[model samples]
Target: MRQHSTSTHLAQKSSWTHPIYTKKQILDVQTAHRKASSWQDRVALSTVKVLRWGMDFVTGYGTYSPISISVPKTRTMTEQKWLTRFIFLESVAGVPGMVAGMLRHLKSIRMMRRDHGWIETLLEEAYNERMHLLTFLKLAEPTWTMRCMVLGAQWVFFSGFSLAYLISPQICHRFVGYLEEEAVITYSKAIKDFDDGHLPLWEKLEAPEMAIKYWQMPENNRCMRSLLLYVRADEANHRDVNHTLGNLNQTDPNPFAAKPKIEIGLPQLQQNGRVKD
Candidate 1:
């Protein structure tokens, strides 16, 4: 009898390598909002606001204020509370992209037409959001209640978003754009909290090894604050990309498919040296 091989290899690479970011690029990520012009835009923005309110209430997330403003002492979030909110946010955040991508893929197959590069970007966004959730999981394990919340939220969101995407891809994309805007705000507030010495434990904490590898983070900037900066930067990009996609016709080619020259007045310095808006 031939001897059986006993060695096993571990998967060492991300399916989609995250774009590397310079410290300046990460720190420069600022919150942005796209005003609602059309009815679709209004609907999308309204939905995001309602959902944000519900999630905040359920998660006990405190309202965010500028660093210059004094936060109420009673409303302060502990490290664990922050992790709880992050976990819940990321769990739902990964839904829209996957739903949109899956629908577009099936539609393409059924109609015998190409998706014009939309599928890849949408799927990649889902993957990136999953990585965010996984990285947070490494820092804090979710309790049974949290796990239940995630399960219920994912099922409801996945179903609702799929139907919405099938009905109006533009509005769904717009909704995601607005949702990502909130994500950037949330992460920005977290970073500010860290900077203000509100999150003491995170001050000395190093990022998880998984996050460092995924973000290709630098040796010097591998702390929790840097990790939040990286995540906030990703959310900011998603905010821009989804809003742009919402503006295009369904058949239009994805502008992000090929690297462009500059993006929203910022150079995508890490990828292709620059990107277009």
Candidate 2:
């Protein structure tokens, strides 16, 4: 029985293995904004703006300005503050994907029709965001106040997003696209802070073990800056993906449904033949 249990554990692997990123790919990631062309797009962008404003206000994060603006910066966020903001951002970010996937799954079942590859992609996105939150949790533990805030925000956002998705999935996708744009910008600023010698601790800090394994980061690129680069690239991909999804009809097939080259295989084993974490 013990041997059978051990074999079962060794066979288990993540359903959604994260994509491996090249250094060039990570570094080349840039913040992009999609223009709102229709009423749905406008409404999505507007809602994201309001939410961003509220989140920034509550987290004590200042408004972002263009890099070309030559103005003296007064506020500098500490490492802890950045972590706090990240925790909140990721906590909320993981919700939309799950809600969309769940609703589509139910609809598929009720209508006796396939979801045309959307359900898997949405669930994978949610899993990726959860990994991001776990990586940050390794860096900083949230306070009870923050926990309570996350609880309240999740409940409200989940309910609202569900209703919105039911009414119009296109708008929901556009909203998520805009939200990912903001995420890319936030991570870019953090990377800039690291580059400018502001985040001294991050300069010397290595990414969490989970992050290193998940991203398949190279030995030399396992630092905090590399982690941000990886995350920023992911947000950029998400931004583009959702914008594209927003433009498609509900019955259309997902364009980004290509399977990964690598399939789930045997777990990495230690020298003693036990599965490695």
Taking all chains together, each candidate's TM-score versus the true structure is: 0.88, 0.86
- Candidate 2 lDDT over 1-277, as tens digits, reads 0011101122225778887888889989988888898899999999999999999877878533446433335445668778889999999999999999999999999999988788988998899899899888878888999999999999999999999999999999999999999999999998887787667878878887778778888999988899999988888888887887787778766766654311221221122232221
**What is candidate 2's CA lDDT for residue 140?**
87
The top-ranked prediction according to lDDT is 1
Cα TM-score of candidate 1: 0.88
lDDT of 1: 0.83
Locate the minimum summed-lDDT window of 10 residues in model 2. 1-10
Kindly report which residue pairs in candidate 2 clash with one another: none
True-structure RMSD for candidate 2: 11.0
**Which residue ranges in model 2 land beyond 4 Å of their true spot?**
1-12, 63-75, 259-277
Q: What is the lDDT of residue 51 in candidate 2?
A: 100
lDDT of 1 by residue, 1-277 (tens): 1111213242567678887888889878999888898999999999999999998888777744664456565567767778889999999999988999999999999999988788999999999999899888878888899899899999999989988898999999989999999999999878877887778888878887778888988888888888898889999999999988887778766777755422422232224332233
